[model samples]
Target: MTAPLLVTGAAGFIGMHVCEQLLNRGLQVIGIDNLNDYYDVSLKEARLARLKKHKGFRFFLIDISDRDAVANLFKTEKPSRVIHLAAQAGVRYSLEHPHAYADSNLTGFVNILEGCRAVDAEHLVFASSSSVYGSNKKLPYSESDPVDHPISLYAATKKANELMAHSYAHLYGFPCTGLRFFTVYGPWGRPDMAYFGFTRAILAGETIKIFNHGDMQRDFTYIDDIVDGVLKVFDNPPEADEAGPAYRIYNIGNDHPERLGYFVETLENVLGVEAIKEMYPMQPGDVQSTHADLTKIRRDFGFSPTTSIEEGLKKFADWYRGYYKC
Candidate 1:
């Protein structure tokens, strides 16, 4: 019999999708999440309700930062593999709530590492972010690029998690992989994200803020592609080498970057409503552009994202109208 897979933040956007994919493959899943009020708690519960119908899925309402609680759960489950996705997310929110980042990203990550160590999990995969590329002059951010200059506290904590996981992999013998995701969007996406916010404002006839005077480009990856890439990496754990730690980081994103102006135009076309753009200077902790170089991930895991902005936005628009009944 196969061991159950442990997924943190199972109530989150990507978490819910990942758990569903695993369960559909006839795998047992044990999910844990505190379901904090970072956004609407109702949305989180709605996501969880979908997973509840699967007999192979079980959930625990717990925070990863609670060290003792995480330790106890790990001791009980002792899962063979774990996917840690629970973190205090939001680059801008980190500016206002710095402690939240420390509590979840730093402390909570360490607790996760200790839990993995306790159970001798074969593989530990976690979420990193493209924001860690932080003002790099390089065109397309690569896995080998230097990430020492993170502009936001959120990015800094993600970079720190990579280093922390490396130490654990080196000290122990388990494999660890960090996935640096670009702008991920689709149905059931975070409301704070620009795509969702733009749709809401366009429907309400409100002005949407366009930062950097609309001189931005993002590698807008679709959520399905992200899940596929993640599952591919999970099935193949790294082998420890004598030269370095058994830890690898990959940039999981759409290779194509869409211009911010074009992105808004696509959304406008899909929703059939023109957005009132209020051009403004780039805010602090915001970068001008992001593009991912998928050489390593492709070479290693044979994974590549294949979703276009037009198709992805159309799917999102269809879901948005039905969800809001607008």
Candidate 2:
């Protein structure tokens, strides 16, 4: 029997997709998630149900924050590679629940590092976010850009994760790769994301709040594109050199950015319902725009996001109507 690859947050939108792809490739997979009610528990369960259909996949209800449980799982499973994606995600929610960020993003990440060390994992591929580019006025965020100033607790935690991962890779002599994902959206996406809420509100004939008064931009990369890039990165680990440890960071995002109003209009068109828009002031801990420089990812892995906003939203809308029976 072959050892399984471990994936944290296996019930999550991105995690579920990654797990499914791995399973389809005939790889043994061990998935773990706490099933927290960060959003609707049913949705997570729905995702888990889909993965359960694959015989190559196994699951455990474990929280990454629990040090002992994580250590024990590592000792038992001894997975050669780990894809860590579980974390307390949300910018606005982080303001109200600051402790959640510290507990999950900070302490939980350390536990993951320890587990990797215990198993001598070949590579650790983890999720970072475009939020870490906070306060940077630069148009396109690059891997070499300075991310010292993060406006939200969520972004701060993500930045900290990168630093933490680098330190662990340096000390433990294990390769680590961090992917900084931009505004990702598609079918089975996070409900907290603006696009998801916008779809729901549009279909229900409710008012959709446009933050920053509809004056913002986002490089909304689709889910399939993200999964494609992730698998490519997972297969290739960085080589160690005299200058630093075997660690690398790349931005996985669509190179093109769309305006906020244009995005809403596109969504409205896709859902066949015009939303009642209400412009709102700039919210705290929110940036005006996010654009990713994908040169490194493209150069290294030949990654290119092919999904357009219109096409992606249409797929999401079709899934939404069918899933909700609306």
Candidate 3:
């Protein structure tokens, strides 16, 4: 029998989607998640329930930060590939709960690296974030850009993950790929995200706060596009080159960026309800805009994001209403 693929954060928004797709391809998947209360536990559970319906899906309630547990699971499962996506997410939350970031992003990541080294995994694909770009003035953030200045603790930790993964890949002679996702949104998205929150507030007839006084833009890539990019990168691992080991990083995002106000207007049109908007100053640890340069991913894997913001939001709105019965 072929070895099962191990996916950390199997219950997460992206993790669940990745797991489902892998399962659909007739591959066994061993999923692990602490199921923390970073957001709605029920939502996470709901995602897990869907994966459970797949015959090839297996789940373990384990936190990657728990070194012994992670090591044991890797030794037992001996997965062919590792997809590490679990992390303490949220830029503002990282500021308030710095310790969470340290435990999950730092310690947990190290534990995962050790697990990969133990199993000599074929490839390790981990989730990075576009937040690592900081307040970069560059129109489209590229993978080669110098990401030395991260304005938020979350971004710093994600940058650190890239560096850490590189060191492990070099030392252990394993292929590693890091994907820096930009503003991922769509069905079954995180409530902390702006679009999700805006939809909720609009339905409640409450005021939606527009940060930076509505002068912001995001390269919102739909969930399906992100999953497509991830799977493509997973199938093709990096090869060792003179410049570095078998390690590479790519930005997974929709290259097109949409302004915040225009995004809200589109959402309003989709939901068939106008939102009461309140303008506010830019929040700390937040950037004015984010855009991803897909040159490398496009050249390497033929990755192309086909979902428009309007179509994606409409799908999200339909799912939102049906899921919530609102």
**Which regions of candidate 1 fall more than 4 Å away from where they truly are?**
none
After superposition, candidate 2 runs with Cα above 4 Å error: none
Q: Cα lDDT of model 3 overall? A: 0.96
Model 3, span 87-163: residue lDDT tens = 99999998799999999999999999999999999999999999999998988999989999999999999999999
Per-residue lDDT for 87-154 in model 2, tens only? 99999999999999998999999999999999889999999999999979988998999999999999
Model 3 clash count equals 0
Ranking by TM-score: 3, 2, 1
C-alpha root-mean-square deviation, each candidate? 0.8, 0.7, 0.6
Candidate 1 per-residue C-alpha lDDT over 1-326 given as tens digits, one digit per residue, 9 for 90 to 100: 67789999999999999999999999999999999999989989989999999999999989999999999999988889999999999999999999999999999999999999999999999999999999998989988889999999999999999999999999987899999999999998898899999999999999999999999999999999999999999999998887787899999999999999999999999999999989999999999989999999999889978788999999999998998888
Model 3 stretches with alpha carbons more than 4 Å out:
none
Reference-based lDDT, each prediction = 0.94, 0.94, 0.96
Best by lDDT: 3
